[model samples]
Target: MGAAAYALWGSFPLYFSALAPAGSVEVLVHRVLWSLLLCAVLLAALRGLGDLRALLADRTRTGWLGLAAVTIAANWGVYIYGVQSGNVIEASLGYFVNPLVTVLLGVLLLRERLRPAQWAAVGVGVVAVGVITVDYGRVPWIALVLALTFGSYGLAKNRVGRGTPALVSLTGETLLLAPFALAALVVLEVAGEGTFTSAGPVHTALLVSTGVATTVPLLLFGAAARRVPLTTIGLLQYLTPVLQLLCGVLLLGEEMPPTRWVGFALVWLALVVLTTDTLRAARRRAALARSAVASAHG
Candidate 1:
């Protein structure tokens, strides 16, 4: 399920690509509004309305959840903008570096100790970022922003616990942003600035599909995250960024310089180290459990 969700998410570039002229901001607005409506209906259908009420009653938790939702929305908006505007390679860089960002966060925020190999991987990432900066003649801000925002979003989510059902919680989040989305739609329409009307049928369908496009995979992802082990999901996360990178280079005709290549290489190295560590830990735990069971049997 995680793989499927990530696959769908990875393929989002195709959907957003067709919506040119509608612009990223416009599409983001629609995504927020439509996603709210869709998730709300689904929640009601699933008899999850009680969960929404429960979430609302806990104002403190709801406030924190709202912050998380907003953070994630910012991450989504930036990512969509990057993809639609032919910056997909940069966007993919974000996800590639995400694991490293999480590691940094752990070190700084959680006071976790890293092994020497982990520190070496982080150093490699720093060098890669320097290479990318030199190649671009500017900091890789978009990629960094995507990474930081998303990393923070994940951290915030951990704090929130199971405050509400996914649908219910996300519904509240969407509704929080709906008014802004509605205003943006109105402003864009009034200014005759939207890409919807001029782009014809295909673009229009894709634009509207952003809502389903956004929500469906998330639902699938939420389901998948629960069913799959963290290690499996951790490995599968790469699929989305890989697809995005391909779309940027092949489909969008974006050029990747040698320095950018080095950056990506370093990021991938960090992920390999992290994922390898996680899998080994899981294996060690399993082996220990087996040994204990064998001793008991003996």
Candidate 2:
């Protein structure tokens, strides 16, 4: 399920790329509006309207949801911009570094312990960032911004707990942000800068589908989350970047310099280390469980 979810998410670049001539900001607004509409329908169909009402009733919790909403919307906007502007490869780099950022967040914010291998992976990621900086002759701030913002958004969503279905939470989250998005759409329309009204058939269709394309994977991800462990989810996250990288290099015809390739290689190596460590940990736990069962039988 996680694999399917990530696969869908991995292919998102192609969908968003079709919205040519539409600015990322306009595209993002359409995404929020359409996603909210779709999510509301799903919530109603699933009989989850009561959950959304309850979420709104609690002003305090709703405030936190609002924060999560804003953060995630920002993350989405930045991502769309990255993909639309020939920076899809750099955007892919953000997700590539996200697990390392999550580890750092745990260490700094949650006081979690890290194994030596984890530290080594972090070290390698640092070198990759340095390589990218030198290659660009300046910091790739957009990539870093996307990584840190999305990474932080993930942490916020983690704190949101899991009482409601993902569809409901997503509906509530988007509804919270919809007013702002609507206002922006109105403003852009007034200013003659809106894409929804002016963009041609292909671009307009692509913009509208952003809602479905974005929400479905998230819903799938949420479903998978209910059934999978955090480590498994962590492993699945790489599929998104891998797909985006392929889209950027193959479909978009973006040129990757040797140094950028080297950076990607280092990041990939770090991910391999991290994945190996998690798999080893899972195996050890499985072996211990089997031993316990054998002892009980004896």
Every candidate's CA RMSD = 2.1, 2.2
lDDT of 2 by residue, 200-243 (tens): 77777877888898788888888889887878787788898999
Per residue, candidate 1 scores C-alpha lDDT tens digits across 1-298 of 7877999988877777777777778888888887988888899899988888777678787787778878888988898888877888998888888888888998999899987767877787888788788888998888998999899878766666653456777887888788888999999989989877777888777777777988888888889878878788888899999998998888889999877887788778777777777788789999999999999999
Candidate 1 has an lDDT of: 0.83
> What is the Cα-based lDDT of residue 104 in candidate 1?
92
Model 1 TM: 0.92
Give the distance in Å from residue 122's predicted Cα in candidate 2 to where it truly belongs. Answer: 0.9
Global CA lDDT computed for model 2: 0.85
In model 2, what is the error at residue 287, expressed in angstroms? 4.6
